[model samples]
Target chain A: MQLQAEEYELQFSILVKRLGSWLSGQTGVAKAYVTLRDSQLLFLVVTKSTKYDSDFEDALSDLDIELANDPDLRDITLSVLSIPNVPSDSLSSFMHPTTNFEIQRGGNDG
Target chain B: MAETTVKDRLRLVERNHDALVALIEDARNPHDEWVATIAFYKAIQLVEALLAKRHGSVSTSHFRRLERLRVHHKDIYKQFRPLYNASMVARYLCLPDEPGSTSVAYFSSFSDYIGDAKAAIINGRLIQLEALVEKGLGEPFTKTRV
Candidate 1:
């Protein structure tokens, strides 16, 4: 069922946190961030391993049934982002500087 | 509907690669952050082509594209995540306060803000993808029941 924009974000964030917690129990998963953007569902994960082999495929596909059955999320396009274990000190390094710059750029575009 | 031939798919891969190259060339112009954002998206398309060739299907959904990438092509996924984040930054998401607000002047200085290190990371991703494409998508695997 569809929800208001605010409600959707709240529900989606809750779903993401729950899914993230469940995924953390699986081997090799460091973290998972479930988010919806532009009508697509994104599963951005950080992992202990960088391999997307048969084993990892199994882990991802295992979610299909659960995700497909969910009333709020089943209809959207789903995507994933898997990254290797990055040191905590370097975590912020993953974000684009321009993104931050753009936000802080503010009314100073002149 | 007639199934798309391998030749046709390969042609699409070539097109994606060509577009990526063009975006890279465009990124060399001034206002690089703006250009780099576009380049990152083209890079995603290029990876999608590679993944499509491997998987025998294509998706218009970004999430599905990334999901399959992580499931099937881990190597590319490693190179792609940061680029994807960078693209998100370029397009929207990961902002300090206001979102989706971008300007050349603001991001022009971003090159200096990131200095050489982060720039290297961004350029490094493109290089890795280019190398992968030059290597070509290898033989497709036949599925077998586990």
Candidate 2:
């Protein structure tokens, strides 16, 4: 499933290059990070906590999409609810970055 | 023949993870951090497989165990810098399937990526994760849609 063939995630910075306006439109947070592994795309969407819920609510409202739990998340379903509660230090324990992938060198502490 | 169920795989992984945890707790002579890194990810894929398969048999307790495991693993992966230089996305997820998407350029091949750096091994294996994530990135992924 890893798309080593084309290196799409590596090109994700290209998304920033080309889709910044589109992204800012979708997320008023003004900060987002997208990474890919093989075929799996890891989208790290961040916003101020104040902005976080509002933006998410707004985005879904505009799209008229219902936010319900389903199979697409059938695998990662557990951690989905747990993320908001993630404390700063526990972030380090994952053996991965604290949150989403960083868009810049020093963004996410990893 | 006794074929392995995703549940069986999960149990094996839990066993292996516990074994590694014991090694970490050893008092006499602690192994280098790299040894633990391998153990962490080896255990990761087993859980990844169960989650990926979406086994019907997984229970609330199972999810709880998995959650504890994932958060801790996330903490461990955060410890190192990429052996090579590259751009990546910040961490955030819109939904359950989307485990925070971002692009990263590192060792494309596991073996070649590590160089002589002992710590680089983990980055090497992270190379395979894309296979898992790409499956859930977009509209096809938004769990509720299904």
Candidate 3:
């Protein structure tokens, strides 16, 4: 059950996607994007509204425990951030393929 | 606003690096958690600036930014992962019931607590990242543009 670094990353990515989809099905959640950096788990959960209801907190608590039990993700810090749901158009734009652009002022343009 | 060029991102990298140095010094004086908080952000901003130079765009989402680095520049990603983890812990993971007040006792036992040596290491990584970005930018723009 020893996983290499790449293996861990791949497994975690799949796990995050599945978890996100499931979380989105819940009452308050609209969409979810999960990331594990250095094995620390962070869920960027898009919510139907800004306020976090009790049901949402309960679900997040359960999700946290579930992620902790996974062999590959155990012992890592787990947290969630709730953000307003994004428009479909904007999400689609974000998914578009990246294009090369001329570097403009303040290479920090991003 | 016009698009940011590699030159602009390079300048940002330098600015964040300078800020990080100052924060490290400030942290030594009062051991304030806010110092670590600002330092963490500076570290992230510095790395993002370097990534913008390479990819021609940088992600706004922290995770996405790291993912891009992992995909395109594994070497840089490896160096950055720990810094990101430390910063996350400093900012989001460990906290007191009160706002703006950090419990030193709580922080001492926090799993991802960033010690002085770790802070130094993060600074060192920023230096390396800056050098790498500058070298990459030195190449012909047409060849590096992607």
Q: Which ten residues in a row have the lowest lDDT in candidate 2 chain B?
A: B137-146
Window of ten residues with lowest summed lDDT in model 2 chain A = A61-70
Give model 2's TM-score versus the native structure.
0.26
Q: What is the TM-score of each candidate against the true structure?
A: 0.45, 0.26, 0.44
Judging by DockQ, tell me the better candidate of 1 and 3: 1
Q: Please state the CAPRI-style docking class of candidate 2.
A: incorrect
Candidate 1 per-residue C-alpha lDDT over B36-104 given as tens digits, one digit per residue, 9 for 90 to 100: 464465566566556556666766676666656655666666566556654543343222333234331
Count of backbone clashes for each model? 4, 51, 7
- For model 3, the superposed segments whose C-alpha errors exceed 4 Å read A1-110, B1-3, B27-39, B95-112, B117-120, B139-146
Can you give the DockQ of every candidate in the order shown? Answer: 0.07, 0.05, 0.03
Candidate 2 per-residue C-alpha lDDT over A1-110 given as tens digits, one digit per residue, 9 for 90 to 100: 65452454444444334234434455334344544332333333333231113234334222211111222232322121111222233233222453345444223322
Could you tell me which residue pairs clash in candidate 3? A104-B4, A104-B5, A106-B8, A107-B5, A107-B8, A107-B9, A108-B9
Which should have the higher DockQ, number 2 or number 3?
2
What is the fnat score of candidate 2? 0.00
Model 1: residue A102 alpha-carbon error in angstroms: 23
Q: How much DockQ does model 3 earn?
A: 0.03
